[model samples]
Target: MSHSLSRLPTLATAAVAAAIAAAEPAAASRAVQSRTVKINGVELFYREAGPSNAPTVLLLHGFPSSSHMFRNLIPQLSERYHVIAPDYPGFGYTVAPADFSYTFASIADLIDAFTQTIGVRQYTLFVQDYGGPVGFRLAVKHPERLQGLVIQNAVANVEGWSPDAVKQLAPFWKERNTETEKPIRALLTADTTRFQYEHGTTRPQNLSPDAWTMDQAGLDRPGNDAIQLDYFFDYQNNVAAYPAWGEFLKQKQPPTLIVWGRNDPFFTLKGVEYFRNLLPNATVHDYDAGHFALETYGDEIAAETLRFLDTLPDK
Candidate 1:
């Protein structure tokens, strides 16, 4: 009888361990997946998390950044929201064909195809820097596909752009000459990339060097500079689109949330006013950090994003 009892204890322990092991994979499945899919012959890289059935949140990164910017914010949202961040043709790990057009319109077209390929019929868009141009283009092309909009340091109104950016870009926007384009090249340096991530945040210490490390690595790749320049020249199209996007916002008024870094050097705080005026009902959350507000204020931003998301009328 004692022998049998001893065996029972060992068996109970084994059963308990097996149960624990089983639960681990479930949690592990929640981890973000780095994946790639071909769209128009380009290999697009993305990070996805949360259940396939959950409402989708499409994250669009800014200049010199990629889906990696959302690394901290993704897990925070993955439990309740399906989050996906893709590296545009000229950015991050995505591989573009030599013959692919590098204009913002073409990039948006591929992303549109990407959504169709992934079977995501609708989603909320989270846009930053370059994302502003890309996301706004997507929104204009197919306004029906937008479930909501989450704007982080992206502007639809040209008046919202910083004067320096507007001034520096004017020549390039007018004509891509050596004199005009030469100045723009300075913005592509590692120093500028690091500056964008570190300049405005309060917690400079915690911000990972890896953010710029990875972004600069991607930038350093052959022919990538020209890809970025094409986008820079193409940015004029996004500027011309301000009126249409503004009108769309006024008409659709999709549930809007604006999270900004007030201290940003590239994009001025004045830009926030344009959104406020257009989206009087839009919620705005401003942080003292720089361009990459999420780097230091992620917990706060994540909470605001969740609060904003829950209040949405539907998926």
Candidate 2:
């Protein structure tokens, strides 16, 4: 009887251990890693995740934001694909040298070098806000390197500009001066930062305050305002290249997916249609949220992105 009791205890312990193991979720194969690489004399900070051999999705962030914007989406996508989100010069943790030109073209050049240095020869480009200009520049420069495109509130057509945004940015586009900068400076305030995330959401209360808090913190950095202003003024150059970008899209017709926020005040819904007109085969998902759709619909965006990526020819 004693022998049976002892055996029962051992069996029970083994059963409990097995149950515990079963209850616990399997550990993820990889976790997001923050890294920095020297490119063009500046250290570019990037967040990377997923297997090196997996198809890569390069995320380019928008203005007043960084790779931090993709904090949630990276790990989700990394489960099945290699994801890279880099902070351009003058943004995020990237070192901005005084001599570094902050124009979209210059930043694009730096990002191109960054990808080459990191051995990312081919990737699906994910562009948002300021990322649109930078990523488009890369697309035009090396169309062969592009495997696909994922656009989130990124504009490539003049009609992408909201009427209000057009009026507000008129002065800066026409001329860069103290008087013209007044309205642009107003956009740099904390309140405006908060509004950018909360304005178009159905559940403004559900949005995390951290979104604006982190963005405002980045903007408050010394000389960042000047850097942003320079980029804002240089945006006119991007507008001028819209036709070329359109032509590239029409020619390459790379499998494209656009996840847009209908509530975005900056880029109009027309922007999504413009790409659709160019690449009729492109898949598009629209969200009720504003400029930063990922902030609100990250899970949905990640799921849709994975679905869209699966449709592409495997590299």
Candidate 3:
């Protein structure tokens, strides 16, 4: 059989001249844009993708991470949903005023202003790590504005915390001193940051070094350690709010979805049960991955998220 020149792979064929798709996974069809806005006296950096008119998915990142953490998942949903992932003050590219307080409540207030500034009236809140507390505060404050909730590797209960954090932070919450802050220092190290990405993931080889390296760079910024320490102490307030957040979930019951990494070092699978208890109807999916589950299973999680989002009643 004679093959046509067009069908053959050769140096002279046009196949090599055609536009080559990006080497990234097909989940990234929608181009993600990095944008910054001046709001609430702080410069907030966020990644935006998809049609502005489409349903919005507000992604709130976890501790020691910024909008960069959502890099993989944004493109997966951007084609059908308006996805916005922002760096909190003192995180990523966000620039906060010197006097700006870094407590979760304050950060939540700023984020509230951020949504109003950017005109996000309604959105599905996707929270991970430190995002759990921040997103909950927003949910409670504006229950009417939430289309739904997506909990990823974050917790509203004490059972979800890793022993290392609770052991150190619990005492710090009780009393902040050099003795209490010592272990806190260890948690903030670059080594610990790298460990977070590598510890429980199923495929370490597939994970990007950029994730933790970028996070460590953010953490290494001058005075960021103080901000992080403040967060460690402020987390006590979050623990106190669990009852109220639980009540909010029971009372509001916005359509809920829970996606988690069963092997996360910080947030245990047990913490997910808190939501399952409050939101019996909430959808749940867990993977063998770690805290940054999307790094390993973004496609699977995105497929699940698309299915769940499809079922929700539009605003």
Candidate 4:
């Protein structure tokens, strides 16, 4: 009897150890994985996490940023969804060739190709800043592939433009001369890059220096400034397509979630209203953050995103 009782305790301990060993794989699976894939003749570096068969969330980053912008949010969402953030050409570790066209349309095409190359037929798009134009173009091209949209400070409405930015951008938009290029190029400075993450956050101290440092490193790459300038000049094309994007939203009525930082000096609250006008049922959450809301409110955004995804009919 004593032998059996001792054996039972040993068996129980073995089972407990086995259970922990089993759990480790799942825990390890949640860790973000970095990878690179060649798409459209350029090597596109991407961060991926979660199961391949799970509902996918494609994170499209903004200007002066890369997939690094979604670094914190990816792990949070990966627990329940497949999260992928790709660095577009001229950003992050993605290689940008001198001959490559740095227009939003070209970027959109690259992303679309990247998705197809990786076998992501359908997904929820998370867009911010430059991602607005790239993702919207993809949405317009392949409306059937979109499950939903999560827009963060991505503007499509005319009302969303800050007067100060519009005034400053007007001269650059109209002409590409040295005089016009000076102010636009000034925005590429380290101060402006840092300001993007620190400007309107409630707790600037909580912001990481690594965010701006990584972005500045990417921006500082040789010939990257000219690529940025080319894209800046081409931004008008995105503006021109806004009406079409709005029309697509009205026509398809894809489920949407808008999380905006009210203090964002670039795209304002007016842009959220424009989205609401299109996706009247879109859940809106405004934070007291700057352009890079994820820097300060990543947890909040991730929680809200999970909640929103859970409530989706297909998910």
Task: Report how far residue 274 has shifted in candidate 1, in Å.
Answer: 0.8
Compared with the true structure, what per-residue lDDT tens digits does model 2 show for residues 121-166? 9999999999999999999999989989999999998888998888
Better candidate by TM-score, 2 or 4: 4
Model 3 TM-score is 0.90
TM-score-best of 1 and 4: 4
Question: Which is the leading candidate under TM-score?
Answer: 4
TM-score per prediction, in order, is 0.93, 0.91, 0.90, 0.97
lDDT (10s digit) by residue, model 4, range 79-100: 9888899998999988897778
Candidate 4 segments whose C-alpha is farther than 4 A from its true place: none
Predict model 3's lDDT versus the native.
0.88
For candidate 3, lDDT tens digit of each residue in 84-196? 99999889999856888879999899889999999999999999999999999999999989998999998998887888768768888888998989888888899999998
| The candidate that achieves the highest lDDT relative to the unseen native structure | 4
- In order of TM-score, best first, we have 4, 1, 2, 3
How high is the CA lDDT of each candidate model?
0.88, 0.89, 0.88, 0.91
Error of 3 at 32 (Å): 1.4
lDDT of 1 by residue, 165-205 (tens): 88899988888888999878988899999999989788988
For model 3, give the 10-residue run with minimal summed lDDT. Answer: 18-27
TM-score of 2: 0.91
Candidate 3 vs candidate 4: which has greater lDDT?
A: 4
Model 3, residue pairs in steric clash: none
lDDT of 1 at 113: 91
